[model samples]
Target: MFEAVLVANRGEIAVRIIRTLRALGVRSVLAASVPDRRSLAARLADEVVLLEGRTAADTYLDVEAVVAAAKATGCEAVHPGYGLLSERPDFAAACAGAGLTFVGPSPETLTLLGDKVAARDLAIANDVPVAPGAEGTTDAELAEAARDIGFPLMLKARGGGGGLGMRVVANPEDLAAAIEAARRQTAAAFGDDRLFVERYVENAHHVEVQVLADAHGNAVHLGERDCSVQRRHQKLVEETPSPVVDPSLRDQLTSAALRLMRAAGYENAGTVEFLVGEPEEGRRPFYFLEVNPRLQVEHPVTEAVTRLDLVALQLAVAAGQPLPFAQDDVRFEGHAIEFRLNAEDPWRDFLPAAGRLTALAAPGARLDTGYEAGDAVPSEYDSLVAKLVVHGPRRRETLPRAAGLLEAASLDGLRTNLPLHRAVVADPAFAAGEATVQWLERDLPALLD
Candidate 1:
């Protein structure tokens, strides 16, 4: 075990990492921006190194500052708790150069899986099914590719995934504008302007397999998660043992995920996301989406079902330790659901809000959050303020408890999407596990009205 580790992120993830470090007896040194000096993560950390800048660009996203803090704090490793610089190859390389272990995949793997286009090609080479797609460095190339892929194709940035630089083009007339917009967004968000076009499945489920590997070549798939309940391509609710996926489909998803992970020589915790279509002829068609090469925001739900500490696993792998368990040893005990509570107003088109959280009341269930009462919800970063995770013996038994928890929970001083989450859990389609990626957007008007 490491004597000390630097937590190089913020919000609920930062706090989550700190808890694991405490349990493992690893001293935690937090790298916080000026605005986060008084954050709950800072209070929980054994030590704090304040990054001078207030904005993400100069602080959390700055590779040099984070590395320097880890070195200065005498940390033996760094754990980037999702987002920010978590998937940045340069950041991982910098940590290696500084003789500090990065508690994630190697830089080489990050470089390979971080680019959407490259990952798609790798999947094809590994014989893993992927949506028909073509890559382009310019609008002309993408425009030509779109003509073959046809209308209703998705335009996505080659670098970074999280629905940031993505657009759905309904027809040729909208291609150029969508291309320009996607390019600009991708360039600003990921420092890459390259784009790709692929066939868009009108009705699909967003299912992802959680896989963990070690440097010693041992790997296993934890299971699949259904993140179909979404809005604007962003996931709002995630659950394990996707209510719609049967045993056969689950085997295919996990097998494909393990094959890709082994082929890429991936290590540590990573997620393989896919777009799954409805069943036809007794089989569901699933296509590769993208790989997230770091810990994900929805990890807690997986933990609830598997009874595993992913953060501990990441640390063990970074220390060059072999996986303590094998494929057969892993078990999925129950169904778990996680609802992302963002500081946004559902009535106003889900506009992000910021203010002091004057009141907060979560009576039961697991609530992972960085802000407490009297804490300010800043507008400069991600809108997510907390995650409410509920677990039950089965999906049917889980929905009511999750709904009740949301009902009892309260947050004041800023608008929240709580009402929207309430509506989702109570909706028949969602409760029946029939919600797709487009369900929320398609039915939002009726649910809200």
Candidate 2:
């Protein structure tokens, strides 16, 4: 391993990476913004480099500043712990150009999978199923493609993820206006107005597979995650051993994900997401959704079940080491669930809540967080404060455990979705594993009442 590495992101993920670096006996240099100067990650890191900006766009998103810090620190590698610039191909390329190892996939693989349209096409070429979609650079072309794709289609940005720059249109009358709106949003969010249309699956389950690849041409998938629970196209909770997926379906999903990664020559840890349609005659068909080219926020769930340290694996892979085990050597234990505890109010349309954490208490479950009581949550960054991960010998046992943990925890000074999580855990639909992508938005209000 390298003597030292720079963490090019902040918040809980930065702290998460720092712990792994410490365990590996590597020095960690954390990049911090003005507001995060005294943040938890900064305190945990061996050294801190202020990025000299206030907003995320000027600090965490600034590639040149990050690279300069890495070089100045005499670091041999940089670990971008999700979000911010983790998925940017240019950032990965720049790190390589600066003689620093980027602890992720190659820039070529990132470029290939970062574009939503290109990823879909590659999936099709690999014989993997994909939702019917058309890519276009202009309004006229998108209009023509919309006619072919039919009504109730999704407009998506090609350059970014995280449910941004996406919209649904139910009819042709709203197509042009939707396209224009998506264009403006896409340009503003990603600096790329290129858009595409895909047939929407109204009743779908979001499932994804975690894959790890090494530079020695070896790849293996850990397992699948059921991420169907969502609000506003963003994941709220994720679990392993999907209640609906059988051994056969799991095999298919894992195989498809591996095929795609192998085709792209992908290395390091990544996630391949899929949208599974409602079962038809006891058969559920799944289509490729997208690829997250970095460690997922929900990775702890996979770790709890698989008993593997994903961050450690990432570091080893970036250091040019082969995987210590093979596909057959991997074994999964019991069920695990991860709840994203964000500084948001569930009752107020999930509005972002920011303030000093005056009082805090952690649940009995495994907790990964960046802040403790007395830490201030700034408004400019993501509102996610912690990830609550729990595991049980069986899936049924985890529900009550998670509910109990949420009930016992205390959080003050800022609104959170803890109540919402409690309601979800107690709901009959969620207990039965029947919650779909739309279940949270469509059925949550009635359940809360």
Candidate 3:
């Protein structure tokens, strides 16, 4: 394990990392914006370095400031909890150049997987299947490049995630406008306007495999996550052992993820996403989506089912330790689901809600949160306040348990998506396995009314 480590982001994830660092006998250093200096993560760290900015863009996302804090604190490693700069290849490289472990994959690996277009090429090279879409970048050349990959394509930012900078153009006439909008949004969000084109998949169920690679070149997938409950590509709920994936499809997901990780020489934990279409007869087909190179917000659900401490593994792997067990040693039991408790209102178009968390508690489940009752949720970052993870012996048991957990939720001082979650958990369609990307928007209006 590292002697000392600096966490590169803020909020609950920072606290989560800090607890692990302390348990491993590592000194923890926290970087924070001025106002966040009084937050829980800062209080938990052995040392807190306050950046002279108020917003995440000027502080947590500032690579220079983060590295400077590490250098100042004599920290030997940096862990990007999640979000913000976790997936940035440049941040990883910067840490390496500064002689500190990045505690994640190599910058090369990040770049290869972060770009949607390049990742597709890698999947193909490793014999992994992807959606049938345009093989090249430059959505601006849509008209000239129509022969190979035709219409009903998706304009996607190569570096995009979190449901930003993506547009589906169903017709040729809307292609140019979609490309421009995607490019503009991509430039605004990630500062990378590079975009790609892929065939638009209809009514596809989103599935992902969580794979862990060690420095010793051993890679194995933990299991699969069914993230089909989404809104505009943003996952709202996630669970393991997908209802649609059978044993054969499970093998396909595991094998493909391992193959790609081996091909890229990847290390640490990562997620390989796939677009699974509704089953046709007895055959089911899946298309590859982009990979997330760091820990996911919904990792708790995986941990609940796998009985693995992913953080411990991450630290050990980054320190050059071999995995303690092989693929056979891993076991999966029960089902786990995660509900992201975001400070957003379901009424009036899911608008962001920011205020003091006067009273906060989630019932009937394991609550992983970065804030407390007294904290003020800022508008500068993601609205997620906590992750409520529930587990049971099977999906049937898990479903109602999730509903019970939401009923117990109480974020007294602030508005949250708890009501929306309650609606989802109680809906007959959701309970009967009819939840989809469009279900929320379609049903929310009437439910809210």
lDDT of 3 by residue, 1-449 (tens): 78999998888899889988898899999998987888888889999999998888899889999999999999999999788889999999999999999989999999888878888899998899887766345654655554357777777777868878778777888877877887788889988887777777776778899989998878888899988777677778888878778899999888998888888889999989888876779778888888889998878888999899888899889989988889999999999988888888776566888888998887668888889899988887778888888999998998888888788778777678778778877888777666655666667676676
User: How does residue 258 of candidate 2 score in lDDT?
Assistant: 96
Q: Residue 429 of candidate 2: its Cα lDDT?
A: 93
lDDT of 2: 0.92
> What is the lDDT for 331 in model 1?
86
Rate residue 50 of model 2 by lDDT. 93
lDDT against the true structure, per candidate, is 0.92, 0.92, 0.84
> Using alpha carbons, what is the TM-score of model 2?
0.98
Q: How high is the lDDT of residue 79 in model 2? A: 96
Question: Which residue segments of model 1 deviate by more than 4 Å?
Answer: none
Tell me the tens digit of each residue's lDDT in model 1 across 261-374.
Answer: 998899999999999998879889999999999988999999999999999999999999999999999988989999999999888988899999997767888889998999
Minimal lDDT window, size 10, model 1 = 358-367
Judging by TM-score, tell me the better candidate of 1 and 3: 1
Error of 3 at 89 (Å): 1.5
